[model samples]
Target: MSIWGRVFAAGYDRIMEGAEKSVLRAHRQALVGRASGRVLEIGGGTGANLPFYGDDVAELVITEPEEPMARRLEDKLAASARTAEVVRAPAEDLPFVDASFDVVVSTLVLCTVGDPAKSLTEIRRLLKPDGRLLFLEHVRSDDPGLARWQDRLHGIQVRIGHGCHCNRDTLASIESAGFTVSELRHDQLLKAPPIVRPLVIGIAQAKA
Candidate 1:
């Protein structure tokens, strides 16, 4: 990880606290509350979603690539009522068998991955035939004017945000990866910057 990556990881929880209280807390609770059977959460930064997982989840595995973030996630997992195995791994290269999980989750992570297509393909590979993928991601805005601004500032955003692209077309990437989107909702975050505020929260199933 780069120095900025380390700095961001160290302050991630503190930075996200306000957004968590305003909207993300509820969004995460609703998204993870429905997950069941074997679960795998990609990019489990600081274990923010750990508290929302339902009791019905048979097993939970969280993957975090950054050492600093993974260590913080471990601390969060240790205190949670729910038990999960925390592994240090990247989203594009998950170390799991095909069709190993019944449900997979991605929240606030698709934007930062080096290759969204590869990561989504991996998510599809890890899911069972009838498995579901629940995601809450910030995506490129549809508004032309705002999109222009996103395009303008994207480079700087990536440099400062630890590889997080502010204008990724995450929903389209999920579709291109062969996951049939079942439900999707678009909205802006309450306390986030406009460039990264446009969000897509939804569920998708791996194509059989």
Candidate 2:
């Protein structure tokens, strides 16, 4: 990982604590009934989903590539009501058997993955044949001007805020990775001028 990524991981949980507690909570709440069985959370930063998981979920396994972020995730898991296993690994190379999980949850992680399609493929592999993949991501805007601005600012943002890119087409990547949309929605998460990102939520099932 880049030094900047490590730095960002160290303080990211603290920096985004409020947003996780506030802005992100409602969106996550909508997913309560969807998560169940053995759940695998890719890029499970600071175990944010631990608190939101449903009681029916038998196990929760989280993968986080960044060591510093993994530490935070461990700490949060310890404090959370949800019981979970934490793994320090990237989404592309998950250390588990195929079809190991019944539900795969990813929130705001695609933008940072070096290859979103590959990561999504890994998610598909981990999911059971009838399993669901639930996601919450920020995608590129449709406005030409905004898209251009995202392209312009992405490089700087990646340098400063870890590997977070502002313009990933997360929906397209998921589709290409062999998942079909079951439920989908798009909305704004922030009200800042120019609106750098639009939040996207979807429930997808394995192709089989």
Candidate 3:
């Protein structure tokens, strides 16, 4: 987990540069651009999605629990020339009131939370009745062979990723948490190892 410390924070952007250029950056643009009104983002790692937020957004707040990541995020926020707030908070324990936000953004973040289901429940609680959750995550593969690989490599990936699980059934978890996945795009995390490549991007809203 020390790797997820200062060293990871210092080199995080550089490490993901290739993946960002290959596929992630575009996906971020498409999903994050849709964010509007009062928005709250979980993790906000390195502020990678910082550049894509559209001007229609009424207010933007990002929470990051890790000190190392939060420091990096704050630094990036200082340089981004954008108007937003950065808070030191975890996904599973956000401080906002219920139904306070119109959008909750989670990009490449759900898999790494301390409690994915609980974190999402908090997201649901924070969102307004019609609010949206914009998410892009790598989940357990549908293929049995690949899923097996994901299972084998999951621990190693978590160690290296600092808490990221390579084999979570994230989409299913979202549905179980009571959100209706309104739009979905199945995709691959290009330029990554097979065990962690399976991906899904989508929008979900709380059920009535």
Model 2 Cα lDDT, one tens digit per residue, 1-208: 6676677877776776666665677888787457988988889887767777888889888899888788888988888777888888898889999988999999989888888878888899889999999999888887788888888888887766678888888888888888899999987765332433477898999887
For 41-149, candidate 1 gives per-residue lDDT tens digits of 9999999999899888999999999999999999888887879999898999999999999999999999999889999999999999999999999999999999999
* Candidate 3 lDDT over residue span 50-98, tens digit each: 9999998999999998888888888888998788899989999999999
- Candidate models: Cα lDDT each: 0.93, 0.82, 0.92
Q: Report RMSD (Å) for each prediction in the order shown.
A: 0.8, 1.9, 1.1
Give, for candidate 2, the lowest lDDT window spanning 10 residues. Answer: 188-197
Write down the TM-score for model 2. 0.92
What are the TM-scores, per candidate, against the unseen true structure? 0.98, 0.92, 0.97
Candidate 1: C-alpha lDDT? 0.93
What residue runs in model 3 are displaced by over 4 Å at the alpha carbon?
Answer: 1-4
TM-score of 3: 0.97
Candidate 1: the clashing residue pairs are none
Q: What lDDT is obtained when candidate 3 is compared to the true structure? A: 0.92
